[model samples]
Target: MSEQEHWDRETDLLVIGGGAAGMATALVAALEGLRPLLVEKTDQVGGTMSTSAGTVWIPGNRQSRDAGYGDTEAAAAAYMDALIGALDHTGIRAAYLRTGPQAIDYLRQRSEVRFVPSGKHPDYRDMPGAAVSGRALAPEMFDGRRLGRDFERIRPPIPEFLVLGGMMAGKDDIPRLINRFQSVGNFVYAGRLFLRYLTDRLRYSRGTRVVMGNALAARLFYSLRQQNVPVLFETTVQSLVRRGGAVAGAVLRTGDGQTLRVRATRGVVIATGGYGHNAGLRARFMPRPTPELSVACTSNTGDGIELGLAEGGTVAPDTQGPGAFWTPVSVTRRADGSRGVFPHLSLDRAKPGLIAVNSAGRRFVNEAHSYHDFVEGMYASHREVPTMPAHLICEAGFVRRYGLGHVYPGTTDLGPAERAGYLVTAPTLARLAERIQVPVEALQATVARYNDMARQGRDLDFGKGDTELNRFNGDPTQQPNPCLRPIEQGPFVALAVWPAEIATSTGLQTNADGQVLATDGTPIAGLYAAGNDMASIMMGTYPGPGTTLGPALTFGYRVAMHAAGRPVDAATGNGGQP
Candidate 1:
């Protein structure tokens, strides 16, 4: 049959969404000798991992397998259960834990993707059964220039957390950040970032080659090319075509509005991310007054989720479960009137002795908790009070010493929000509280209570004195009470904070191998989902470390292997890498 008269294109596998998961899936399929077509709607790839911190928390990972650390599946399972508590689902959790190591090992051996242990970044639980040091893995830095013009398409790391130019930081460097003389390593690291920027500018006419997010994505993109994977950017899967209740192929739409019907001989993998960007889905699942903020890629809009739902798949935690969303982040408007969001609270919670309170004049959680925990509490608080926003309170010392975490357009040279004062500032705690519309007396009393505790060298109200991560954000110059010092300096500030959905964890339900399943427990033949597009295997709970990317890549590989008919290695219990 003529090419145009017959099916538009035929491939063994069609992987949608070119993020970490989709890229990994296509790579595996290509390696398995299956011609794979990768569809990424965005101009570039690397979804959130490209523009954000590229850490993949894989418990009992092979990265630490040689360090003499014990990381059995049982141990990892226990750690997950402890961290997420009664909220986690055992079946899905077990699959994630058991398959994690093999997943890491497969990627390491087969692709340019490499990881190093995130030393000292503790599990959400300091609990037993957790690998003390091997639980987290971040992408080793890669040069973005390798992708050529594709490098320009990929999203670079946001600069708020990026001190010099690099957007990643060592786990131990969190606390040592504020200590000017003491943070010699951070200083040297900053110097290296600066050097990376200069080198990239001279060689590639781009300043982002050495950074974390773009670098990681660039590596995966390059590796996918080397493996001969067919990546089709600026293209989208319009709908999944079915034959006898099985996915047959997809109706694809190109940037030029050309429609092509491609046959998926094996399966169609949907890693198109969740519906965070879709207002209708967000309103349906999330509680009312859901702000239109998303830290995830703009490209994620439930395209895969919608297609799966239309194909009669069930989406679980569909209505509830921590709302299973990424937290609202602090952002400022740029000169172009675009907003830049930053997740770093290193100074606010750690060094500036800032106290976060809701609109109702109360502290809801330990301000020093992980970013995810903070968002969960924000969601809960918004539900409790009909109020639309929360406040981040910091004092003069915080702004003067640590810098009120600035958000810039593309880089620092572009317009920043710090100059705009979307970050509200005031002379007194009372004035700051009043300006932000919180009850003044209540705010003062809260600060006074914190000050009393700080002077006594303790934190009785909240366990701020607990972790090194907390102390890193504390005022070490204040003696005895590093994290306990209250926001006492003359000028205090409070920013209007809201919970921005980075990506919804709640999504289409899938089985152990990343195959979408009907409510009756039968697999949807020739259909698969991964990344934020797939239902979170951890249930509604966020596990410690690289919770997002871990399952994303793992399941991506699983779907490709299954599609390619690769044998499952019974000994390793890992399905063969495609």
Candidate 2:
């Protein structure tokens, strides 16, 4: 590799990683009248945020209040106290609680980012601090055409999440499009969306209208561009430049194998999207039998964490839970020979007429639980029996209505999926057990017990639909228990699911100001971390929809303010007392 000797660039602030946190850092710095340079290792921006649902769980945010929810800071604090319960990172938690709404307000007022509270989205656990709704906020849908030619620079969502090869849909769009056959209004709404998508395809390589995480990423990307913050794609930091024991800049390596020295006068922010794909780090930090599947950006291989560590930053110690965010994933090989891991996040698992059984063909968990909780069940089940590859068995009618994994609902052609061995089908329950390699009698008895409970509209075995969290992701239109329909219909389908990580909870330790801290509990000057690169504020607890993103945005804002020598008042948006 050819390396350049002289300084190739200079800026007030340098933000590494193009995901939400990095973008927020650069955006805030630019807004504060500093010249910011953002670098992304990938060919495009958006990192793992582009592939997510784009929701941020920010308690006491204005959007929630504006949406007529009575969520207060005290309520949020009480909830956190109940859930976190004497963790060491209370300072980070306090900072997040105080600054989260401020961050949202700043972004809404100054940037293109717009968030609307998911008024009905419940917290992940039904603990004392949990809210039934109004804490999670999602980015409003964005029109990709606004970006013009720059639209191509925004990383697209996962291929499996799209419809008709390109169009991105939101949570609400799914039911509308799927139920179009039942209602004329739904049919027209879906028709218009498809029409818009088809027209967009004629002009662009993919649909120009985007939603969810893609939209959130696009909004941030648009804001950065609008602020004239320069972002270098396919560029990464090789090493942090230190002067007087403080990070001064970085030695950057470009995609063409050329290296250049870049100086930052303010600070360098590390936002590389965690260590999800780094095998060595995973083996060290994760629980035994480390997950091989990750839904995070493939480029996220712990570059930022390693860089911070090399610069004398400390990693947070292990907590009560696994130091990684997890989800159950189903894999499919595309025609192009690339494997696609579809995360079972609120699509089919929580809905009625579904049951997840281990290799012994026994039900082990409440099927309607959150994805993180579902993986916990897998881990627990694995301790007893072989449950690494659990099967999500659903009836033919459920498959036709709700779809399993990557298989779409009302799919006329199962030829491609069947050829790829992604979908296992059997006309009888015994046959399904045989095909999936589970015991026949065990499977039959499990379904029989489940059917009796479903008929009574109650889950006596595991209380599947008992909690608000379970019902939140379920089909509300169902009679009696929303998440408890019987899976008695034949021509059954079963999709194999594996433990997969969505994000790493363990990361570089940082203080309340988002400054990277040393092992001796002192902040490393001019060094900061945000997004998944920073140890999670929740301390590995899956609080709600946007726990990762909420802290990411808040700390990104904090890092920029601290670097700019601005006062950070957590109580108000304008740096004032409440």
Number of the top TM-score candidate:
2
Position 49, candidate 1: lDDT: 77
* Candidate 1: C-alpha lDDT: 0.70
State the weakest 10-residue window (summed lDDT) of model 2: 569-578
lDDT of each: 0.70, 0.87
Q: C-alpha displacement of 355 in model 2, angstroms?
A: 0.8
Model 1: lowest-lDDT 10 consecutive positions? 407-416
Error of 2 at 276 (Å): 1.4
What candidate 1 gets wrong by more than 4 Å, as runs, is: 1-6, 68-70, 83-90, 126-132, 159-196, 202-205, 318-320, 345-347, 384-387, 407-419, 467-482, 567-574
Q: How close is candidate 2 to the true structure, as a TM-score?
A: 0.96
TM-score of each: 0.89, 0.96
Model 2, range 11-83, lDDT digits (tens) per residue?
Answer: 9999999998999999988888889999999888888899999999898999889889868777787788887
Candidate 1 differs from the real structure by a C-alpha RMSD in angstroms, to one decimal, of: 3.9
In model 2, the Cα lDDT at residue 50 comes to 90
User: Cα deviation of 306 in candidate 1 (Å)?
Assistant: 0.3
